[model samples]
Target: MNPRFTNKRVLLTGGASGIGRATAERFAAEGARLAIGDIDVTGANAVAAELGGVAFAYDARDPAAAPQLVEQAVAALGGIDILLNVAGIMTWGRFEETSPESWQRTLEINLSGPFYLTQAAIPHLKQCKGNIVSVASAGGMHPVYGTSAYGISKAGVIAMTQSASLEFARFGVRVNAVAPGGVATPMHEKSTAGRGVDPAIFAEAAGRNMPKLTDRQACTPEEVAAAIAYLASNEARFATGTVLVLDGGQVTG
Candidate 1:
């Protein structure tokens, strides 16, 4: 069978690790030409080398970096057929306890970053009728304790996804998001590691807000990557303004 993404050019953020790395690998396997951007220069370059793609040093929190990253991708790959907004950060704290710096930083990385990247890539996406797939979180859809800032940032992503979908449908460019619950990623591990939040509190929160499924395990990066791939593929041509929740019944149950 022919590869699903043969001749497609894809630009991805956070491509050094976690869901972004997995998604990059998947796209490469499907014959995509990739341009990976991440703050982890060494890691990004390594992935790019292995995948025969290009890598850029990117800080999603920087507005200037957004256009620069897109420009670099376009220059390297000729044009972009897909954009993946997978770079984000999370901090654990209740609304009252969350520091202003933490809140601002979370919003900048998780929400504003995607927004900037999308704005920069829109023209290119329009030219190719390409689609975008963002990695939102289930926390956005439901209240999760000690994740006020993180959840709000993801909620903005969900909102942006739908808004972009509607505004860009006339251009034949689709925008969609995957609202995954806890995914087993280094990002998650690091976020909780140094944070003073009690581990039991997270467990309690998860018990209340997550995994209505029998297997309450966090999702694998590959699983979320697969969902993202589906949303970006021609298989989902008719889908737009859609938030595919991969939260194991978190919303429903």
Candidate 2:
């Protein structure tokens, strides 16, 4: 193993599953000292135990939780060299069809959580000249028929990444993001399961969301994780305020 991050301290959110879980594994394999944060305490603890890292319960909807997670992570790992924001959710609905409650919840977790986490971690990150990598979505860049809340939230993330990069550049803290298209993750099944929305609506949308060049319609969590890892790595040292779009030509098409 290259172990590019040997001894690097990392604090990652959404580490319980999907892109977050894959990102945690990637960082651990690269020899990072990780602190996994997630709402799924059991799953977060499991991942942490397997990787010999610490775990903290984190709910993205709770504004106060971000600072606490950062504090706990800094305490656990000494200081943070990388802050990976991979926790997010997507709810399916057109603008009018979406509920106010659903919209608020989506924004809280997908947008506000990262906002709060970044603010809390900036001081520590500045001390280490650390980098930040967030998982954004191509939906933020392109027009999808039925994902207003998710799209808007992700758009805010992209804006946040860029804005932070500009402000933090003098401090030597790099901020970048990976905007992936649809990914094969549990969020697809879990996000809309109980809602009255028809699952076929998502299916039809997925069909139309295909990449122009690649045969695959969606990326795997590990694939997105790889992009996240790259952005966080020294290999991408010169990159900041950059969004590496990993949609396999979906947007360009």
Candidate 3:
């Protein structure tokens, strides 16, 4: 209705649920044409249909899937004007309990996925002078116990955001990332539920991780999506190489 993104072509990974799903809805409401890519084709299709957009099955764990997802999205949307990289996973375990496999999978999804997808989209984005917004985590900023791999991976994403911004500025493509603390998303639910880790424990840790002046509270996916929209909008044209932390002010004082 706002038409902020009227006729703008967008490609989003992890669009099946959580922040990604919320983002798709927000972008659609703002009048953007979308190509939703998710590992879950059923959910992706559902969101895409609801938004009058197309969907693609995307498995960020697979290195090859990045280029293919981009190709499919380009074919469906004509060209990419905005890329939202929200596809990621959580691997919770102590250092001793964490496996090499777990590290690989987490990194592949949370770190490698964004890297490869951004690399693949750079050319298309350069042509359109588009921008990117990635979903990092509060864990990336400060270690969240029991999620070393997830934290490391997300930290990598945060770094990649700034690095890419510097490299792509000359091409007129902006890169930014959001670092959110705990959110009431499926991923958070799955990570905490019946896992022997008390929910309050994370909340407490999240609170302690932030500046003493700040408090901890779980935000909704839609709330995070709103931030992504701003960074990708014309409003943030002068902003780049920035990591926006939306963790109830935990990351900052």
Question: Top lDDT: which candidate number?
Answer: 1
Q: Of models 1 and 2, which has the larger lDDT?
A: 1
Better of 2 and 3 by lDDT: 2
The whole-model lDDT of each prediction reads 0.91, 0.89, 0.87
Backbone clashes, each candidate: 0, 0, 0
Ranking of predictions according to TM-score: 1, 2, 3
Reference-based lDDT, residue 8, model 3 = 90
- Answer with 1 or 3, whichever has the higher lDDT: 1
Tens-place lDDT per residue, model 2, 200-244, is 666656566668866766778998888988999999999999999
Q: Which segments of candidate 3 are over 4 A away from where they belong? A: 194-216
TM-score of each: 0.95, 0.94, 0.92
Model 3 lDDT-worst window of ten:
207-216
Candidate 1 local lDDT, 1-253, one digit each (tens)? 5678998999999999999999999999999999999999899999999999999999988999999999999999999999999988877887887888999999999999999999999999999999999999998988688789999999999999999999999999999999998788997666535455668657666557657787755789999999999999999999998999888887866
lDDT of candidate 1 at residue 63, scale 0 to 100 = 95
Per-residue alpha-carbon lDDT of candidate 3 for residues 1-253, written as tens digits (9 for 90 to 100): 2568999999998899899999999999999999988999999999999999999988998889999999998998889999999988877767677789988999999999899999999999999999999999988988777678888999999999999999999999999999988788888887546354546545554425543433435788999989999999998999999898877766674
